[model samples]
Target: MRLNDCLTPAATAIRRKAASSRELRSNLRASWGDGVAFGGMVGFGETYLAAFVLAAGLGELTAGLVGSVPLIAGGVMQMVSPLLIRRLHSHKRWVVLCALVQAAVFAPLGYAAWQGSISAPAVLILATLYWASGLATGPAWNTWIGTLVPPGVRPRFFALRTRASQAAVFLAFLAGGITLQLAGGGPHLMTAYAALFAIAGGCRLVSAWYLYRHTEPSPMPASMRNISWRELLGQLRSGNGGRLLLYLVAVQAAVQVSGPYFTPFMFRKLELNYGEYVALIGVAYLAKVIALPWWGSMAHKVGAQRLLWIGGAGIAPVAAAWMVSGNLAWLLTVQVLSGVAWAAYELAFFLLFFEAIAPEERTSMLTLYNLINTAAWVAGALGGGAILFLTDASHAGYLIVFAASSFFRALALLLLARLPAIEAEGEEIGLRTLSVRPNAASLDAPVLPSLPSQAE
Candidate 1:
């Protein structure tokens, strides 16, 4: 059956199920609200912290390194997180633990910065703690989400959540930028930024608390004794999994290579003031919010792989636009495009990832996926820095880096083309021959209706 035809009954079923379940409805609303709040506070803290680091006599390379190092460390650590989760047998508890750790770390980092001891090493250490928190939380978070959010409703639900989150991020950026502007880039400004971080940390704590309150249906453990490195490697070599891995790695490498430099490029090369920088990012995020729902719907309609291609194809020109123009107006325009592209890429990627794996394998697959993505980001940052150093920070250096990255992303898109499209969870209409695990009673209500026993 055609993909769209298969999806009709599933969509109808989901609407019916949603109308029937008051409890599920309430949980969905809460999750959406919490997600928005968490995203906003974090985005605010990140922008302010980054600007503060730049203002404190750190160079572009150092600032970029600050962001990239944690990712690298997290990537390396992520390989073990799944094993830890398996041993612990509790994803939710680990996520809360990570959040608590983050809160503890942030409070001190902010206090120290307020006391005027913000050094490169100090920044790196704080970042390490932060990223470690991320490493611990990410796989578990994804795993939990997989269970909580049903597949049929994910597109619409995520679209709403992302829209709200982006809106929050927009406000946070504006607030942070305004605070910095009022403080006049002096030692006092550090206190304001530090306070922002503290508040952001508190917000995360609240989010963690809310998450703990969420009821997750328990998952069946993998029958295997342990997930070995060899087993992971074997999975990576199998079927569409291998191809998807390569595509993800390549896309991550491409973006990360040039991604870390974006803020630095604005600060160093363009000499954007704090307010302008915040405004730029805020607008970009807003653009992303506006574009996300469309992308989500498109993914449901067409397929994720095609959307990936669109995202991959768009990056190069967007990067090249920055190289060519270097004007704020033009830069903002490109950032808007980049935001749309990123939204499409992210939404489609997550949906496709969930579709790709079995429920039993999700934790391991998610951990491995995050590990590779983090590793790619680190490598990209380091590689970009190396290229910049070699070329003595020339404009040509950035152009060369972005160009190469874009080319590789395009290559990844081409690779993605070879993989078969997975059916959307509810959308399987006439294919009764292929077997699927029905949702158990303990599982959330089936969002999509079962397909007809036989195709017409």
Candidate 2:
């Protein structure tokens, strides 16, 4: 009887582990499906919010603000994710709800497109809803999925997932651009936008369905506990993580000074058709995609910190490079350089900063970080908007904002000086095992330093 009792417990454990392994495999596949569908939503829908604002006759300032400002509302709303998850007792449920809401947001956008006009207030409100729902999904989803994906596989798994996501983003974006281009300079342009947004909404719904398909092994991991301000503040203090966060926020602020206005600049001042605009961005997108493997290899050879320096230096002059020429060829050259630079910068931080956060605190830390990051983004965009407002959104005004962005980016590099290297969370990384890197489609947003790598 004693031997039988002992053997019984061991047998039960074996069965449990086998069950877990099966679920893990299932969850990983679901995540890939989710990635592809989510990428489709982002590509068809999220990338064009500002351009839509411009097409709606909202003027340049409004177009610029649409991309960065609503993010603050999203950030603030996501702060409640932990409490919501605690009450719901299921991260999966909360995430699915958020994703569904995000999908729904595009419906009204499509409607507004059909109408061919939406007030600035109405547009901002819809954007806030869109961003709020989208941002809320990040923290909870990160905490939930972290448990599903084993640490050993995280680097490679996320890399492959990122590749899938990027591929979808590129294809959907290209299709949307082509549709708009085909519409030509005519009344049907808004109709094309409507169709794009509707398709985007559907893609997100499919993404949510896949999220539902994921098996939540643990409804509440120990990591989901409340984090005290003392702990939060400790994470933000002037250590490696803190300095890195601050530097990243600064860089975001610098980047946004001109980032949000580029679309309008292309449409208005440059007089580029949708095809030319898409071509410019597509070149950059393709460049970034092709360069990722190379950047990953470089990171392995030189270490992530050095990689960060290389990327940082590469990006600083990019905005200013815009002032050197308005010629399409020159702009395309700049974008190729821009794509390669951003890939390195984004990958370095994914390795160094994201990996440094303890898994136990990642949920709360990222939730809070989202708020601060969004605020910085809004501040910089507002600064540039003010410049454009004062200068009447002229070509010279655009040039000024672009120059200032580069200047600030150069100044922000001061913080990166003397930074301590933090250990990465998993194994050595390359294209073979690197984390997420945003494609050019991500440029429409503030590109907050927080990893879409984790929450995305």
Candidate 3:
């Protein structure tokens, strides 16, 4: 009787494990497809919003404002996301709602374009509501996914997810860009814009449906525990997580200083068509796809903080590289460099961040972190706008902003030294099993000798 009883429980446990594995696989496949559609939507829509404003005869400063104002409002929305999520009692629900609203916002944009009323101010108003709704979905989705993915599998999963998404973005950008050029070859370019936006809306609607179908592992409670402002401030001053957030903020701000104006510079000054613009971005995305696996493998061996340093240092020169040339080959080379650098940073940033937080704290901390990040990005865009205003949109003015961005990026790299070289959720990092360095070949010996903990 005792043997039978033990066997029954053991057999039941095996069955349950099998069932869970099946579910995880199902969710992962769904999520992968979701990523594909979402990536396509971003390429078709998000990447072109500023450019569309420029094409609509809004000029450069208005383009900057269209990107900035909506984003700032969205950042403000993030502040309330935690409270709203608590009241709603479901992260997935919040994500679905927001995603749908973001999708719906684009419908009007398409109509506005068709109606010939898509002015800069109109874009700002519509985009704010669009971006705010969209931005609020981010932290919620991150937190919800945190619960879905097993901790042991996060690095590989995230890296793969990123690679897949980047690949999709590249392909979609090619198709969308070609579509735009062909459409604009017609009698009315506004019709082309409208068609592009309609496709984007459909892509987003599919993403929302995927969001709805993803299995919610558990219902988030109505209330979450949060640390006091005083406590959070202390951590920001001294803790690893806080410092990491600071580093991300600094880097994003530096990037945005010139990021928003790149399209304007390319379109107005370089005289690139939509196809050429998409090609530049596509090259970058391709580089990331090629580089992701190597970066992912290195993550387990060298640690995310160290990789962050390498990425930051690599990225610092890329924006400034723009000022050196307008040659297509040179710009393509810059885009490739930019993509490789950002892949390392993006992969490490997320893994380390999730590692630092306890599961219980993810909802609040992620939301707050995103809130601050959005604000920093908006501030950087505003700073760039100010510079453009002062320069009166001269070629020299654009160059000055680009140069300032590089300087700030280099400044941001200084923060990496302050971060600890630890695994996402483990002890201080040291010489570990080194993976094959991308450029180095084995000479029947280890490429990297186990050394003292710090590379420096």
Q: Pick the candidate with the highest TM-score.
A: 2
State which candidate, 1 or 3, has the greater TM-score. Answer: 3
lDDT of each: 0.63, 0.78, 0.70
Note the clash tally of each candidate.
Answer: 2, 0, 0
Q: How many backbone collisions does model 2 have?
A: 0
Instruction: Summarize candidate 3's per-residue lDDT along 1-456 as a digit string, tens digits.
Output: 565476677797897899999988887787777777777776677666777787778898887667655676766887777778778888888989998998898898889778755766678898788778876776577657656766565545554665566566667667778877777644476777787788888888998988888898775733345655566557566667887888888887887788778878888889998778877867776676577567867877887777777788888888788899999999998888887887677656656765655555555665666567768778888898899999898899989888988899899877877676656622221110100111110000000101112111
* Candidate 3 weakest lDDT stretch, 10 residues: 441-450
Alpha-carbon lDDT of model 2: 0.78
Better of 1 and 2 by lDDT: 2
lDDT of 1 by residue, 219-304 (tens): 43333234566787787687567777777777777666776677777778778787777767766666655665577668767777
lDDT of model 1, residue 196: 79
Q: What TM-score would you give candidate 1 relative to the actual structure?
A: 0.80
- Screening candidate 1 with a backbone cut-off below 3 angstroms (N, C-alpha, C), the clashing residue pairs are 6-427, 7-427
Q: Assess the local accuracy of residue 439 in candidate 1 as a C-alpha lDDT between 0 and 100.
A: 7
Q: After superposition, how far is residue 261 of candidate 3 from its true place, in Å?
A: 0.2
TM-score of each: 0.80, 0.89, 0.83
In order of TM-score, best first, we have 2, 3, 1
Q: How far is candidate 3 from the true structure (C-alpha RMSD, Å)?
A: 8.0
Scored by lDDT, model 3 comes in at: 0.70
